[model samples]
Target: MTGWRRRETKREEQIIRVLQEPPEAIDLRGARRWRWADEHWRVWLRRSATGVELFTRWQESDEYRYMLGDDAYQMQLIEILTRATPRDCAAAGFGCTRRMDRACSEPSICSRDPLPAAGVDPHREGPVPGGCDSFYGGDDVRVRFSAGNRHQAVRWSMSLWIDGVRVGAGLRLASSGWWLDDRFFVVPAEGPDEHPAQEYTMGDLVSVIHSVLIHDAALSVTRVLVPGPEEMWTEPWVVRDGDELRVYPDQETSRGPDRTIVLTD
Candidate 1:
């Protein structure tokens, strides 16, 4: 009887332990809920009566990590293109195609080595370093030049100009050997005859600018001013040039000069 009782107690304790521990599987039914779907964690953000609610589904898997890593890389590219300046873009190889190929490859590991340095072989043809053409919107921007020997962190700068007048400058920091995600906005002239506000995607400009800056040893104009939208009176534009511009924008200007640039996580 004593032995039987002891065995029963142990079984009871085990059951209690299982119950006490947090559940590996979660029930997502609340306003903002995340759950496992298609072998991946799904996150949701819902608007509640009062405000907004957020939820997430936790998944422990390597594949999930890979997806997250890819997402991070894409976000980094966006940030670099948006916030980084011409010098920052050139040094970091913001729009180099060859470097992008290597960076996106299996061995590159987006976290370890984001962009290749200038002169360093990206192990591809076309150009050694990369170039920047125009700032648009996208997930991927090729980086050709290496980040120098320090390999400590990624650095970029931005100098805003209005009508050839320098207004402001910005600096960006990112993980070593990793590309930083950024975004940029440019407003040219407010007129009907000027070239319609041209949107240059980072992916499109990186290769051309990378080659021009890194290999060609030339400082070219990566950004140009054009007519903004008809509805909007003044438009702020992102400019990428080899040499830093003197004129920029006034942050406190009432003309909606305030620009919000960020990296999407």
Candidate 2:
């Protein structure tokens, strides 16, 4: 009598062969490998009572380096070659490891700060004390100031440019007490159309305010909240000057004790 049994298919056998052998033992010498598609080095292994594993490393070509920076590529390599325990791997699913997943899911670590919008001044300059740069689409721009002493203040000003023409300015304030005081001014692009959009494309030209300084608190302006553009309702804008103000189309204006605006023709 023959007992009924499910036999492993040829494909499964191939997988088993690749998995059971040590990755270092695989022969990759003299293979016709494509620069982008093929790995320069590889390792294969099988856990004693679990599934299979594969490790691969590719040569860093100029194209790859240009596409993904060196740091990012190195991080990717670290994530792939390192292996987790069988239980950790099994919990994640076949062919997946917890470490790899965690590494992949981690957010980018960058050290940059956001720039003030056009027309506002933070009044004080090095790195925005605690401000960080924001990533919107593919643009990576920032402005920050650092002070020499804990009691000192740092100021930043941004000048806005559209089509290479100066349109408005923004100011940011950073002190020992508060790291960032943001302000903005509205300079209509093409005279304000009813259907305005927030999509920024190449060659659209945007600049920040003019000057930023790092000096004693006595020389720095006090913290003030300025209103941002009318379209950006929730973002507060502040000023560092004490005596001037201006209004824009479809926008309301507010004044504060420590803030002011100086408009130019």
Output the number of the TM-score-best candidate. 1
lDDT of each: 0.27, 0.26
What would the TM-score be for candidate 2 when compared with the true structure?
0.17
How many collisions per candidate? Answer: 47, 38
lDDT of 2 by residue, 1-265 (tens): 1232224465678889999977552245324332212111111122212112211123333445577887665444323323322221222221211122221121111112224441133333212321222111012111121221122111112332211222223332221122222322222222112223333233322212111221123233322222233333122233333434422222244432223346331
The true-versus-predicted C-alpha distance at residue 151 of model 2, in Å, is 20
Candidate 1: regions farther than 4 A off: 1-103, 106-265
Candidate 2 structure lDDT: 0.26
lDDT of 1 by residue, 37-153 (tens): 211111111111111110110112234346677556434333433333322332322233334322112111221222444324212222222222221112322222222321111
lDDT leader: 1
**What's the residue-level lDDT of 27 in candidate 2?**
43
* Model 2 ranges with Cα > 4 A deviation: 1-10, 25-265
